[model samples]
Target: MSFLRQRKTTSQIPLYTGLQIQTSSSAVPIQIVYGANKIAPNVIWTGGFSYTTEKTKAGKGGGSISGYDYRCGFALGLCEGPINAVGGVWSGQSITYLWNLGLGLFYGSMPQTPWGYLTASFPGQDLAYGGLAYVATASFDLGSSPSLPSLSFDVHGLLVGTGLINSWDANPALVIQDLLTNPQYGVGFPAASIDSTTLLGGSGGSSYQAYCTAAHLALSPVLANQEAASSILSRWLQLTNTAAVWSGGKLKFITYGDAPLTQSGVSFIPNVTPIYDLADDDFVISDDADPVEVVRSDPFTAKNWVTLETLDRNNWYDATPVQVWDQNAIELYGLHMDSSITAHEICEPSIGRISAQLLLQRSLYVRNTYQFKLGFEYCLLEPMDLVAISDVGLGMNKFPVRIVSIEEDGSGILSLTAEDFTGGAATAAAYPVQAGSNTALDHGVSPSPVNQVIIFEPPPDLTNGVAEVWIAISGGLAPIYKLADGTTGES
Candidate 1:
């Protein structure tokens, strides 16, 4: 006996409403009504959804939901207002008008103070529940026809926990460790388990420990716990030469020297053969037609030089300048000041070097952005996930890229923005090689090997009847040095 196999049919799924708004003042959730009513046929809820993340610079995510509220003759009985009254209020039976007037549970003024959550979920999708969300703003349209009422909300991702309102003076790493291990901080998972890949232990572990001891963070009136953690983690990464990523429901602070993600390491691939077929209408591609490649002119410079200046606990000042310039860039565009950044929290020479390394790496600029849209059946990719794109026609043949952003339209389409993984390699190559003690300067300062030497005559005003020349060295430590009176010393 032979069994017959059934083929699955593909159909577009319509989005069903699964939104609930609960305020701190109310015990029950507010039921949002959609569509027209008998007395107010024009008043209808169009649609609204929010998009938020903790990955962005704002360190918070927010989105708005909007709909139409038109006033027609058939709805005038429901929209009639009091005459000759100051701040005249509407006594309409229209649901939109009622919502606009802050009537019922849809209190428009509730969000002015701290309110409750706006939870969302998809009925049939796995892991469809959204994080707790705070309603930031809600406004109703008051214009003529087809007015839209929108409610803007922010997701309670990493920054919704109790804030550190007091001043904290301690080792940056210890503070971070305390926050990561504390449940009140809302960073670590249950039982305060951080990912093992964290940089607290590694070949660079000793250096990280030194960084913890050397740098002191004085944080006063810090924001939410997540934000404070993010701030401290950011400083620690800069000082300890590492990176932090929130993945798998845990926070992991890894070093930049870690191996890149390969095809074997990715959770899953989307739009690939055997898994997905673009030829079979599985995905659509959109490339940036006029992508920027390089910086060719002024005001568009990279950080070739970084000066780290800090004061110790005893108020002793220490300044260390590191230069990592591209000779090709200088020959092509001349010397442009990339960054003269200052960090007061850095105290150790090793931390200063790490900070310099980070700044130097970021000085290498390259921009190439691409976007793709995949069907809902395809697995969703989060920001910073590594994936390979294979498009022969567009010269993206199995090229690995990092996801920059992801968006899901209500129509079951997932959109993603991916870019070339140029992770600090451009300027990494420009890092100066260590030199021997014999190459040290007469003033007991040993500078890195110079890549390019530039000499220029001083302007007449500053010379004061003396012949003066300015010397600029590129690609080594200390790109700019002043020498005077034929002395071979840096001034």
Candidate 2:
């Protein structure tokens, strides 16, 4: 009854149908997936539905007793192809073993070998759903039921090209490109849609890997029916704290900052100067008043403790809690709270804790929001770019702020909203130690290695019965056996 033990609900109990896969509909949206995910295929092809019955009495009784079985062949459409492979196929909450399925179900794409059921049913007719990942089975048993069971799979949908193939699924920057360029069920954009300097193409270098060298920043997400494309893309932007916008008539990904897992340095490092410095002269005077409006959030808006929720790869990708406490915030504000972050794509606990701490720091430290108007001279200015604001009327020196939004009216008045972003506040945080798993679950004990083994004949006084030899062993016990011959004749 301890919480350390795995919890099972009624739905998790194994049944003839097995664990359920992602739902499939007659008109289901094919997912543009990366990495492994549980999914159910849309049954595109079905044929050779037959019922088989056999008589069984006793083993040799030869009496008439009826046992019924329903069987069929099917082709299941999964996702975009050519994926790496299909595995972890499951039925009814358990791994699929030697179910009453026919031998050698095929897992592949394009010019796929047609099922014999199809070939036999439709002579010389073959329509292989090219570029579409799917699975085909010749014969599947359904006990007495005619419909298929609750099938599922841990499908590994890898893009195969540019020599990177399976390796790049973890990198969201690289993976996003594939998702955009895919002609089927994707935006089908050309590679030119992305500017060479786009952060996804490594705003700092040619590869995001060269920019952010951390495993946690790499994302594993399945783009499916649940979310719109914009919403799905927002998840990546929020998780990485990066942004994507159109400037210069091209899509540009902007990584103004990052909290990398393995790296130790400033949250972000941007080249100064060309950062679009704005002086009072550049500000558009409004209502015969100051050109900027600043709103400072009170300390009540801050929290000292934050908990991040994410999936744990080691624990079957189930939800796990990663808590972080900001000591400085506690001293200034008060105690703990969370629910600000739900990064299901983050699979590493350390990264989750780091992100939670980053949120805490930002909440407690980032206190001001600025709004002002500039002329069209800054029309080329885009979001995610750090800018400098100076207003002598407000008695403020050159202050740095990151552009959060930009808008232009018919009057060509460019409206901008910026937030205080100090690189010093982005420094890595060291929260107190996180709680570890319960020690009560560490009950498994392994036997130690054998220390010695001796075999010698015993004296007649020491032995009650005659014996050829007395063999003594240490360290562990085993059922008595004749290991020299690999036989158990001498028990």
Candidate 3:
């Protein structure tokens, strides 16, 4: 057999430039404005989404509550150029109108409505497309004499499908097909609408069933379309046991078993070709050695169930409740109550499962963390994306982790903070027990017989012929002892 050398592929970083700004409130299609020389090269954008379950007391008859929070923001520099009547920064009438609102200009004595839809995009990068953002704050900062005469704009708002500002009425039991295709209530993307073809993976059918069986899925009197969608999506996922991702102007319903998208040179894989060029001087990696807080919560035992309340077509209260618990989790991390209670409209078995999953997932975050700083090599990496990191010298080989946060500095360097997703449960299981470790000789033990003896094995590396032992009585103080010479110590 002929021997062949395995060749490694070089990581290529995509060059990203230009930001496209579009308006969605207008009837006519507005031209997408590209941020060229007018916009600063170092544009910073942040998007965050998370779902958490709050534990409740055992006898409260309450199940775990799952809630999601999503937000996005963008900060960029805009050059205030000379206003030409026809084609300058403030030229066209429409441009002037938007600029006036962005600048918070007052109409006569009253301030004009500053609410509008803004979509930012980067034409050079595949993953740089942004969702609709309600321009909540458009603050501008004028620099000092030494700095360039530029205007810095900070845009912050909820994602398009997350606000509760719109109101509409619909059938109580709307199917997924109708809800998504009706053009009024569902995803209204022209070129990026979701369909049955997209939901083939995972629990898409179950999610569809959940959506169809949902009672009074209509938007509330003061709910926005996006907010309504968020609620519906959350409930559907909870019931169907599926996951959906919104990116690049499209909504993709995915399952846990779906193959993760592998981006070359972006993910770290140990013993394999490096996806990133670590030898670059600008590349920096820092380890966060802080102990991860162990999050423990009581499982949704059979005694504790979820209450799903919904309004029927006649506006009557319809409640369905179920129990969702994982015996393994409960056995590992005793009964820790999560007291926060939140109401959900949809009542399905999947709700409890989703909540339990949330608890189990949260418990897995108790692991070491690492932060990476690369020079514009991984700008396309988004939040929630799984990446591999393998630094053999640092004892980190192809460690799979998820990106928790992404930040871009003024110099265009991208900084990412990631956590070990696979090591949390093990770390938590191996945590040292703190009970009976402290010495308090002044404390007196009650006149009760010590009936229970607890023994803790010493670490394998410690060859000393000694183990920790504790003696306890039902109503008396517990004492600790080292088994070597029977030395007694009060805990």
Candidate achieving the largest lDDT: 2
Name the runs in model 3 displaced over 4 angstroms. Answer: 1-181, 191-228, 231-318, 326-333, 339-347, 350-355, 358-370, 392-394, 423-491
TM-score of each: 0.38, 0.69, 0.33
Best by TM-score: 2
Error of 2 at 278 (Å): 3.4
- Cα error, candidate 2, residue 210 (Å): 4.5
Q: Which of the two candidates, 1 or 2, achieves a greater lDDT against the reference?
A: 2
Q: Please give the distance, in angstroms, between residue 396's alpha carbon in candidate 3 and its true position after superposition.
A: 2.0
Pairs that clash in candidate 2: 18-91, 18-92, 18-93, 19-92, 19-93
| CA lDDT scores, all candidates in order | 0.37, 0.63, 0.34
Ranking by lDDT: 2, 1, 3
By the lDDT metric, which is better: model 1 or model 3?
1
Candidate 3 structure, TM-score to reference: 0.33
Per-residue lDDT value at 235 in model 2: 74
Comparing 2 with 3 on TM-score, the higher-scoring candidate is: 2
